[model samples]
Target: MDQAALRTLIGQLADDLGWLEQHARTQPLHVAQAAELHYAGALVRNVVGPFLEGHAALPLHVAVVGGAGAGKSTIANMLCGAVLAESNPQAGFTRHPVAYAPASGAVNWPSSLGFLGTMQRLSKPEPSSLDADVYQVRRVSEEAGQFGVLDKFLVWDCPDMTTWAATGYVPRLLEVTALADVIVFVASDERYNDEVPTQFLRLLLRSGKMVVVSLMKMREADAPAFVAHFQREVLDKMPARAVATLTVPHLTPAQVVDPCRNAPVYRVPIVNQIFVLGEPVQAARQRTVRSATSYLMSHQQHLLGVARDDLLALEGWRQRVREGQMEFDNRYRREFLTTERFRRFDEALVRLLELLELPGVGRFASLTMDVLRWPYTWTKKLFASAFARPEASSMPERQVLENGLAGWIDHLRKEAASQTGKHPLWEHVQHGFSAGLGNTIKDRFNESFRGFQLSLGDEVERTARKIYEDLEKNPLALNAIRGGKFTAEVTTILVSGGAILYSGGLALPFVAASLAMAPLSASVIQMLTEFFGSQYVDFHREQTRARQQALVAQHISTPMADWLTSWPTTGGSAYERLQSILGRFPHNLQQMEAAVQAAMM
Candidate 1:
């Protein structure tokens, strides 16, 4: 596939998994998987797709991500080398991100399709509103270009990931996280060791992102020990492509308000590190894309674990269907097809032998045929005649079919009841039986059985007619029969004092030999005719039984089996869609992974 098709697929798969995670009914959500799914979608939608679409990687992103009240906004302002970020005392006050582009050389920050996912871009500043899924872009100037790193950067003052409000905007947080070429992780002394922030840091590092950690609001004396502890606790235990840490002492109120002049400690090194991390903007962006997608590719199974569970449930249903089909077929063969006697074959044989008579002597030939059939006709006539009457017999085909269908349902019901709570399929089947799956199938079977009888009768008539016509239309067979009659006449002629070699004997020795061979030839012709007619009858009998089986399979068994097999997917239910979602996710995810990885290469 070309790049456009690849992009479409990647976008579609990202949407699919994201939708499944959000909507599909399934087992309990794995909290880590849920979060990772969002992050993974953010990676594909904001980073990989845009990169593959030839979006330029310039004015690289740096997100300020930390916990609530961790001085994220203050840190963002200081990083701007001036007060561009909103500094609010309310914890998690920054509900949406505010992008601070460098006034010096900030163009091509990010188009809506580039890095912003489902978020709407605001033309003007409105970071305090908690209602919209939006982010704003603002340009902040450096006095005399003191912190020139801002020239090639778009710093995002993002929302806190620790507050209750964080849940609502976590997707927005992830979008920034994936878009950034660098992460400026600022942990206030109180929030540094917290589990939520620490776990978030681990995720960022494991993606091979370049992270610069700033220990915010600490004493000059405590900075050394805290930095060492933060490294041991976070950096050492974490994974990363690059990590650099610095300490920021408690700033004066004047310094906290003014970014460039009074907050030199916070402003200088933070800028220097981000600048160094994002120096070659192209390389930095590529590294971020590779790391994020690699993380997505590696953790897909874990991310799609809930979907996998749904798939397993569907597979379990399929297995039960197969087992039920086997039971149904086995019962049919055992109870009906194995012992069923076809009376049509005997009728067809009677008709076939009647064809051996010469024209205008069918009456005499049929009588002769009746007498000959007495000696070598089917020995199973007793059994076949019993079925032919339909009054004195074993279980009929209809009863066998009804019983087989009932047994099939019973087996499925028992199986479903066995694992009642294990999956939705069982529950569905359990309820389906209660709602009359059996009766529905029986009603359909009644309709099909009527059709089956009509079709089978027609087929048998055709078979018998074909048998009768074959020998009648054959000249060789007709001539043989005529010669048999002629031989019989000749034998009588010689016995009555006449020549008998087909009624002509020139000498007495010839007449004697003809007399002996006459009876043998007549007997041989009658035996051969009976022999071949019997074989044809038996062949047709087997075919008729097979045809019966096929009718049962097609008109009865197959339709029922198909309906039962597809029961789970028929209803417009969440689990039905869940099957579809699970089916599409794995292969599409693998393709998306391969496509992005190949594009990266």
Candidate 2:
């Protein structure tokens, strides 16, 4: 594989993953999914960085690891063909990992860039205990033997898992385990088949780590059968997902002291043969890497699925908002409109016109004549305005209405927040709920009210103007304005004169009737003004509330509910969106895996 090609691929993958991470921050479907994607991406970068640099690289590492006193140091010293560590016969004697590199000193450690999700690089120093956080590199000081194949290898002495702080070290162990092409699982005869080690074996099998199991101090005759049982109960039971397995024969303390001479030594021993002289070792290592890669691929779908689940919840939240809006609508229509403020639509204004019963100019002309009663007009207008109390309807105030609705939506968000714990996706939802609902409600309310007000005000002004024009065109209807003598003459002519004489000569009765009709027409005009004015205002109020309810119901509620409901089935977001996040890791991993295989070749 071209080194440049692989690097390009990895870089592209990193960029894609970074974009997803950013999106997850904004539009997270689920908080748990977001966290999982983030961590997986980090894992990809850690696994891929080493191979992108080409193959004049660090030795393929194999760490001799297990619980304390599991004979890791003995195995480490034996692997190097020299007593490099002090075998104190004490439990947990060798504290830190002591690397055994090729004696040629020509090899270099793998570059620490982009490994283990940006861990701090540790210098090579023998610490008091194998601080699981760090690893040390030591060079093999002996001359090379016939097999130059061992030159490209390094061993790590790791902390024991049976300790109290082992939980913390497990992640550290996984870090190195991922880095290693192979693992040396050291189990003494006393400790073999124990629970902790068995569980560790299962974990290794799951991650596709190659295993070399050393069963120390078994009876020579029992070794074959022991290996068989170990394979059946331990290896065969391994979920049909076993990585690799190898068994080491028994070695007494004396034989361990001089393993080259006393222990069966065809390339060290049958146990050592698996690591040292096996024809299939490289193939087995590749199989393990491939299996691990395949497992990761199977889980990639889940990485995207988590984000999908979170997105689905948004729809449910929106439905709740819609139901609330409908509830408010019912309450407002029934409670607010039933008040006397809206009930006496035209009655009050019609009664006010009754005070002008003395009659007036023409029908609409009374408005002008009423204005003539200037001093008493203020009192009349005051009495007219007081008939129906506007205060009750206006008490809550428009500001209060708007603020209350907004506060209610915010309260809904608070309820959501209380239910969703420590989840980053909920944080995103909270932000969206606050900002989206607030601005949408405010803008909709203001726009609806403004348009309704302008429309109703124009209609009322038109009705008033039309009434004035009609009365201005007629004046015989002003007998009340003529008053006293003119009124009495008309009444006397109508009462005493013959119908025949009163008929053609400015018919007195016709004139009196028209004059009487003046106030009646004015009352009619007042009724029209009051009816339409109040009706127009009420219509607009209902429209405002209705539109607000619609906005909450349709724009916000439905879409949100849909997003939440579809979370599980479609894996949350659309395939393209989820893939955008998942694609990042695989793209990076594919490039690095190919590059590493090529470099080794």
**How does residue 134 of candidate 2 score in lDDT?**
56
Clashes in each model (backbone N, CA, C under 3 Å)? 0, 11
Mind giving the per-residue lDDT tens digits that candidate 1 earns over 269-327?
Answer: 88888888886778887787778777776777777675665667777877877787778
Which residue pairs clash in candidate 1?
none
Please list the residue runs of candidate 1 whose C-alpha ends up more than 4 Å from where it truly belongs after superposition: 1-7, 24-27, 104-115, 127-131, 217-242, 249-267, 345-403, 406-547, 554-556, 570-601
The deviation in Å at residue 301 for candidate 2 is 5.2
lDDT of 2 at 598: 68
Report model 1's TM-score to 2 decimal places: 0.72
The C-alpha local distance difference test score for the whole of candidate 2 amounts to 0.53
- Please give, for residues 272-314, the per-residue lDDT of candidate 2 as tens digits: 5435523354554455445555645666556555555444554
lDDT of model 2, residue 23: 57
Give the range where candidate 2 is weakest over 10 consecutive residues by summed lDDT: 337-346
* Candidate 1 worst ten-residue window by lDDT: 371-380
Best by lDDT: 1
